[model samples]
Target: MGGDPISLNQDADLHLYMDGEMEPARRAAFEAQLASNPALAAKLDEYRHQQDMLRLGLDMMAAVSVKETETLAGRLRWRLDMDRFSRRVAPLAAAMLLVMGGWSLTVWVQSGAGTGPQLAGEVDDVPAFADEAAEAHSKAIALNTLQPSPPQVEAAPVPMQTAQVPLPEGHVMTVTLPAIGPELTLIRASIVPWNHGTALQFLYREPDGELLTLFVASGGPAQDGTLHTVVQDSLRLVYWRAGLVAYTVTGNKADGDLLTVAKKMADSIRRS
Candidate 1:
């Protein structure tokens, strides 16, 4: 409300709407536009994803009522740790059985006969963070750093790098990486510069042989401030903000796993 609203089109506008900062009439107008626009509806779905996940994380982590709790970090961390272990094993155990049996299959595949239905002239309503993360992930695969690019570059791997200096944006801020699980270990911490600002992309090696990157950008908290996943070609990213930072954990089709990590990270941060 303090800054001049820009036709209410910016990310902060999403914040304002979710934050209930708009007047009743303005909010109704925005809702009208949203209802009539499928693209806008899809975008709001992304924001809502985050909001729901964050709320779930809080509920899972909250011990006593907020009014009753003091020094509750330990309780929250224990629950998060338990949740983390439960998620990690369920998948690996299933996959390991396949590997042992020499079984392999893909769940989905797109044909190259120009049969896919992408808009020829239609525009995407997805947020910039999703686009940025997807592009970088594709490139990371193209470079063949960790694995071979999927034929679909048909795909490859990401080369890992660490950054110990400020990014070009002149300001550097990052959230704590998810508390590492035994099944995954940190691999790379690199500066990923996006259109709005620089995001610190922390890469991790998972047991599945695929890679994970967590992008953290500072100072642009969405008003809704929730955890949501944006699913797209070549990648999936779960985004949310806490305190001064907005964070996303992206991967090469790790939509479900990413959200699990996101919720754990969110819970971990909220614990303190």
Candidate 2:
């Protein structure tokens, strides 16, 4: 073995020799030089050891990178599935909330807490034409168009003030004359224009000279035989339905008194 190191060009060839890229003749010559030059041989051993360490480090990094990529892909897939599930469920949850809210609102309205009209019976609401009836009464009174009744007339079907205005065809309603107490005199009876159909308006005079109006229409709901009352324009109005005929009695009287008169009138029409 020589004590001196190899030349620079021969040292550069060491890697080619170690990697077996050198020609066979050159590889044999380099091996003989390594056997004789101890320093060159030691240097080749060090380069080989460094290459092995670098290869081991690169393998470890590649394994860690692959594992991390798999974990990241799994988390992304889980998140996508959760997002899809939420999208499918969102509309159903919104619909349930809307239905529940509507139900609660209906309950509040029916419980008499809302601003809608209150009823004394199991009926849903006041007659739809109640406000119209009240307005007609006021207009008639303001115009002083009501006639005075003949003194001491009994409760009977009064003569029509104008030509008979019949309900529109296809309406199943029976126009029955209301038989109220003798204390209420029929002052005027006429057919008036109504929204759903023609309506019968009857003007009556109470014992105290207070005027009362009874409006009859064909647009009532199914007869629940319940009396409902509401106040409009400072007038107490009592209303009910019998079969297809609906009746509203309005007067500047106490609620109980007006309701009593309405019930009697409704009963008379039902019997007729």
Candidate 3:
């Protein structure tokens, strides 16, 4: 009776929604309320802005790795009370800005600010996965080289054209091995297990005798078809996601067209 009952109830519901704790039916109901209540919708937008700022500030500070930032951001999202989010984030974000230096911070925030959630954190999602893919490619190649080549027979041929790899939870992904050019041959397709999940690795031999591996996994943080590239040492990784699956093309740094190959793979997956 003392406060607006609708605002008080919805403020808590909004927090649950943002924290990803709301039940599906309840979430649907809350979203329907957003359609009818302009004030509630505005409040939702304000909270989202604050959430994005907190994530971006933590990312820009240079003290947190992407994985650690995601964990801390999750806790921050849960604890950001409706009335106190701005107060709690303002001082920390300001200090992060100072630590990052003014000109660079200004450019980064300007580029990503108010562009919705994907652009807010997409830049911070690629490095860890890219490193893993590169490592997997290296290890797979080393193992393959240690094996003895099977005898070639006139009547028998090995099947390297396509492979169906099994995944967790009874899932399966079809990998169409590509022979891109005369010297680029699809060598092997296999499963590599890691922290996130099992990835289907399609290994190929390049024209320069270098190995290229395309890693496909079922899920990734950014699935909006944005290509992210990272280079470490001698390897370059071009990553993108379409629908429910993600793709990464890993090759030598000298191979300047890996991004083009990744884009073509993404287009093929989307079309299929």
Candidate 4:
């Protein structure tokens, strides 16, 4: 009786007499309100220690339910008799391997003239093809580059120009070219300055005015006598080559309107 005691219908008749499903006059009025309540007799001893730990975990799952139903009926009778035990052991394992290969060829023809049975030295375990044939003969002697020099000196830097400004109408831009060729329609004056053979810096403007960049190089204008170039500082740079990929488009916009928008986007991709 903690001062003004029970009465939400006597705490739903003490939870239906602690759930033994009530009725003996509502379990004698919930054992006379748990003998006049010391906090309802500590909530009926914590609901009888949670109904005796749920009947000792359902009597340990009813003692392993008959040894898990006889190990699931012996794995469903060994998957319904595996094809009559592989048709009774495949012809007695091929007549015991043809009677042990005819008694090992009649004891190697009665131990012949130059004797037999001297084998014990097998250490191969399979891994030394001479270190993979000496790593494929040191990768064929480092790809055979036998002394022949002086033909690869490309380092001519001094080209920078790019500009393409014109997207203001509805302003939406996202260009990622260099997957080389065909999908080209990037207007707003075709922009450029993506210098190959180096001296780079492409574009920038994202103080939330959104415009950022990148245009790198390592040989373009398909090499021989190389000539694909464009540069613009303040923003703009475009360089081009289409098949084996080479493209550049920087931004900050000025070198003579980014080299006249990189020569009208390289003459509109060499006239389509």
* Model 3, TM vs. native: 0.44
Over 1-272, each residue of candidate 3 has an lDDT whose tens digit, in order, gives 12223578888898899889999889889898887777777777888999999998988896746764576576457545632876778688778868878556355433533222222222434555566788888777656555643442232222334456566788776655333444456677677787766768877766565678988775555457666766655566777665556667887533335654565555555444
Model 3, position 253: C-alpha lDDT score: 33
Candidate 2 per-residue C-alpha lDDT over 7-27 given as tens digits, one digit per residue, 9 for 90 to 100: 998888997888888888888
> How well does candidate 2 score on lDDT at residue 71?
64
Alpha carbon deviation, residue 66, candidate 2 (Å): 99
lDDT of 1 by residue, 85-183 (tens): 978896887688677863332222111112221111212355676667667665664454535443432213332222343445475443454455565
Best by TM-score: 2
CA RMSD of all predictions: 24.0, 33.7, 19.7, 30.8
TM-score for each prediction?
0.44, 0.47, 0.44, 0.16
What is candidate 4's lDDT per residue for 135-203, written digit by digit as tens? Answer: 332222222223232243233331233323223354333322322222222111213322122212233
lDDT of 1 at 190: 72
* TM-score attained by model 2: 0.47
Candidates arranged by lDDT, highest first: 2, 3, 1, 4
The local distance difference test score of each candidate is 0.58, 0.70, 0.64, 0.40
**Model 1, residue 21: what's the lDDT?**
89
TM-score of 4: 0.16
The 10-residue segment with the lowest total lDDT in model 3:
113-122
Which ten contiguous residues of candidate 1 have the minimum total lDDT? 110-119
